[model samples]
Structures are given as structure tokens and as C-alpha cells.
Target: MKNDFEDKMADIMLGEAVTALLDEDVAISWAALTDRLRSAIEIETDEDRIRAGLRAIEEVRREMHVRNGEKTEGKRVAALTEQKLH
Candidate 1:
């Protein structure tokens, strides 16, 4: 997202992903989100596109994680300990 084009791509893709899930009551899991993006949007499965989309997805995931008061990086994300979640 260092460039405008990458940011725009992430924003547009994120919007589509969010919209694809608006009518459902599915859990907000990463797997669910990825599946929705795959099925609902005709994403070209090129490695670069997948990587870019993953980068965008990580933004949302990171925000949610930080909002839940769990600060982590890389592999530490999965080992999140019980903390005072706001």
C-alpha cells in the first residue's frame, strides 16, 4: 500500500468483499472472507493478485486485532494471551 495504485486496489477489493458479505450472517473469519472473495468476485488467481488481496485482508485483520487490545506481530498473532480487551 505504499503506492496510490496499491491502495486503490486494496480499497476497491475490500469494498467488494464487504459488500459480498452484507446479506449474510456468516462469521467474520478470515477463511470466510477469503472464500467470499473467491466465490463472489471473479478474482484472477495470479500470485500477485492473491498476494495483493492478502495484503488488503491483513489490514482489516490487523485493525480488528488491535481494536480487541491484542497487539501482535507476525507469528505472535496466533499466541495472543488473555488481556484487558477494550
Candidate 2:
């Protein structure tokens, strides 16, 4: 009974959580995360809901980090810049 927007939002939120838990590169796939979120929402248990809510919070934090451009790598910077920092 969820609308398209709600479903999409849930998937996005779930993706963020998995990304945070597994690290940005190793997180669960979007398809898998979405399925997991949907399953969590469908469950009647309070514990499961709480767990899923925690995951959702982690995901939001990760997304915020990316949005703020905090993540960086020396690998992408030129050798000269890297050397300057060292």
C-alpha cells in the first residue's frame, strides 16, 4: 500500500544505512537494501523496527557526509600536492 514516493524514500534511506555499516564502497547493493528495508517495515516486532530505525539513522549520517564533501583521498590529488602535505 506504500506509494511510489514512500517506497523510493525507504529504499534511499536503507541504502544510506547499509553504506554506513559496510563502508561506502562495501555496502549492500541498492536492490538488496531496498528489499531489506521493505521487509523491516512489514514486520510487527518492536525490536526489528528499532534496529531498522538505527540503520536508517546511520545511512542519513553517511549521506550527509557525502553531501558535505568531507570524504577525500590523497590518491586523486596530484603528487606535488600530496608531497606538500607530507
Candidate 3:
């Protein structure tokens, strides 16, 4: 069905967006990231598909935040260990 195809396209778009986000060598702000997603999704005329893409992007953002927090925590722990050893 057409609806199913649209859903699949949205999923593929979301995957591409997440892959670009993760593959970045330099860090980018959340606002910038969302702005980029919004721009990318602007080409979609279907309201339902747009909303679904946004929801998926939000989930990806949350997961990215969690991963970033974990990385920061690991660095902090390493710093503390080094300080204690000195």
C-alpha cells in the first residue's frame, strides 16, 4: 500500500539521519541537529509521515544523549582515577 511505502521511506530517512549524526567527527548541538532534520523532512508532503519522522528523530536524540552521557561519565571516571594515582 502507499501508506506502507511512506512509512518505510520515513524509516530509511531516519536511519540516514542517525547515521550522519553518529558519523560526525566534530560535535554538533542538539538544536542544530534538529534543525537539520526539520530541513530534511521539509520535502515530505504527508502530515502523518512528517509527524512519524519527527517522533523517530526525537527517540534518536534521546538515545544519543544517553550515549554521550555515558562517554562523559567514563572520561570523568578516568580523570578521577588518574588524579588518585598521582
Least accurate stretch of 10 residues (summed lDDT) in model 2? 67-76
What's the TM for model 3?
0.58
What is the Å distance of residue 65 in model 1 from its true position? 1.5
lDDT of 1 by residue, 9-76 (tens): 76777777777677676666666776765654355666555655766777777777786565446336
* True-structure RMSD, every candidate: 7.5, 10.2, 5.5
lDDT of 3 by residue, 1-86 (tens): 97677667667767666677778753566665676578777997877768767876776688789999999999999999999999
Model 2 per-residue lDDT tens digits across residues 11-51:
55575557665764555654455555555556636654545
- Output the better candidate (1/2) by TM-score: 1
Candidate 1 TM-score, true structure as reference: 0.53
Pull out the clashing pairs in model 3.
Answer: none
Return the TM-score for each candidate structure: 0.53, 0.32, 0.58
- What's the ranking of the predictions by TM-score, best on top? 3, 1, 2
Instruction: Give Cα distance to truth, residue 40, candidate 3, Å.
Output: 3.2
